[model samples]
Target: MKLTRRLFVGASAASAASLSAPMVMGQARPRVVVVGGGSGGATAARYIAKDSQGAIDVTLVEPSREYYTCYFSNLYLGGFRELDSLAHGYGTLASEYGINVVHDWAVGVDREARTVSLAGGATLPYDRLILSPGIDFVDGAVPGWDLSAQDVMPHAYKAGTQTALLKAQVQAMPEGGVFAMVAPPNPYRCPPGPYERVSMVAHMLKANNPTAKILIVDPKESFSKQGLFEEGWQKHYTGMIDRIGPDFGATNVEVRPDTMEVLIDGVAEKVDVCNVIPAQKAGRICELAGITDGNWAPVIPHTMQSRIDENIHVLGDASAQGDMPKSGFSANSQAKVAAMAVRGALTGSQVFPARFSNTCWSLIATDDGVKVGASYEATDEKIASVEGFVSQTGEDAALRKQTYEESIGWYNGIVADMFG
Candidate 1:
């Protein structure tokens, strides 16, 4: 394959004598323990395993055997894609790539010992650790909302059953009823996720319950692709959606799952379905690892290595890397960079300059898609955006449809790149 920044698996590598290796040369091979089986971790594990060619031992620790993609889940809610299509397994990585896939939760990390303790009473030692556990909701972010209340007012941000539950609740709503969403604050996973979800919800409601209303209680004043989403909402689902920003007291929001009511600025509003995407931080395991600065783990942009600990590398939404939006595309991009850096460190392989890129696609209405993307370079400070592009506000139907088609192709390509 051609050597691009995105696909650097087979690119530049120079062999070195065994004396140059980081770990003990004769006793065992250099071991890499990757936490989380999502975009960043999976891609990192696969790339390292494939590129290193058995020079390193790669063990991927993910609780779930079947991983789901949150990228195109909005399309699933809009009925454009099936749930099964978004699900992928670890069989290929385990069987074909010689990766030790452990279907268990990583509960603790011993940085000094370089060992990871799992929930299943297993201790795995490693020379390097990659953390891509994704985001977890901050406690008390939405008043009266927590993990327990998820059954009544589901935060379908994690995909899988939560996504299915939210979809079911929308389908079971009363005719002309309301569907409310509590949008998250800044620096959350998937910047345009909530808006795309609103568009998808509106798409479904317009067909089934035309009089159904969609309400957004957002803390942020403006969001990614605001113009594109607003224009699409007007053209596709006019009068069906309403947004309550900070100006309208959206910041002071609370939910009552027991009563199915959302208190927006102390005003109790009843809703048929509620998706409360609370404030997000790095996964809880990051706290266990003791590497987070505030809510997220800080990483050196060049290698995606945790600033607190050189052996640990943080990726995706859990990282406080600058500029890049917390999206699957961003995570995957970072994974390639991390994979290359990890291999070079462990096996004394040649390392190239770190380059990253990401694109986030949102389906507003049927065959109507909008996107924002950028190519980045690793600067001394952060991952700086070198170039960018976004979908035009007023594009022809053919162009919009083409963009939608492009998104589908991307979905296929990314999953293949990740799982395979």
Candidate 2:
């Protein structure tokens, strides 16, 4: 059924009213518990409930009531969007889709017992579990930086308040001050994210502090959309951005939060602002559940079922699925596949073949955008990419603008798809 906004609102109201209604005296519904209500979990919870038509009991455990999307957060930094525009609530999922949205952290999981323990001292029994806890930082990934030092140098990778803090710091930069970014290595969330962030920061600096400089210390020799990003930087914010790869001693880096000094290859340089994106691993809950292989949880690509436990499926950045970049699009796509499979297992619904696709669009400057994307299918070994396309180095202004507009449309469509 098509879920129009008006219909969704009405359905949600009805669901809310029915929350107090007594359950059937003898009916036994299969329960599915989902942890983390971001792109993956929320989508999975909605789909299972919507498709099952109340045949299955769906519960979503998320610590935060309001979710801020990591996608398009760079646009927020670039002044293309408002922070509030990125925030989403679970009311629709609760009232409209009949999902039990519990705003609490999932602290533990007992695989044998098939139950999830919440931080609020409640235990949810589940026939199936969906884990989509997203990315967590690796300890000491960046020297002299940890969670406590976030106030001095905001990563802003998680969106929400960190994004606002970074923007405020960028605006408050002194005349011709230096802004440094310690970019993450390969296999991180959103491959094009850090570069796009650099572009957004440059955009802000150009309008506010034209003479300010931007420095990127990257562990990887190359980054996503490298050619396009370099071209845009030179054209729009000339001589303002400099990126140092491993060859330039980018690998050996450290930061002093107190002095705002970044040490690159033993050379100490004081910066007015620092953004350090640390090495990432699966969310902490995955490790607590003993489903992770140190860094990430392994999954059978065809169904997103955890190799460790068939009853539990891991999606998005948490799963070590082959060849798929960790992005909101990837997560949403994986969620649908997992949802279908979960429904098939529980309610005997018809399961479709698993196919997936992802496209990452980035805004370089105002109305200037670029994207890279591919389609994939589940193979015996992995989810292998079949065909792909990327934005060229010398695209026309009209095409770039069109791409930017397309990104806006996608953002709206995706949020609706996930929330409604």
Highest TM-score: which candidate? Answer: 1
Off by over 4 Å in 2: 1-27
Q: For each candidate, what is the lDDT?
A: 0.91, 0.92
- Which stretch of 10 consecutive residues in model 2 shows the poorest summed lDDT? 16-25
Clash pairs, model 1 backbone = none
For 139-190, candidate 1 gives per-residue lDDT tens digits of 8999999999998999999989999999999999999999999999998999
TM-score, one value per model: 0.95, 0.94
Each candidate structure's count of clashing pairs: 0, 2
- For model 2, what is the C-alpha lDDT against the true structure? 0.92
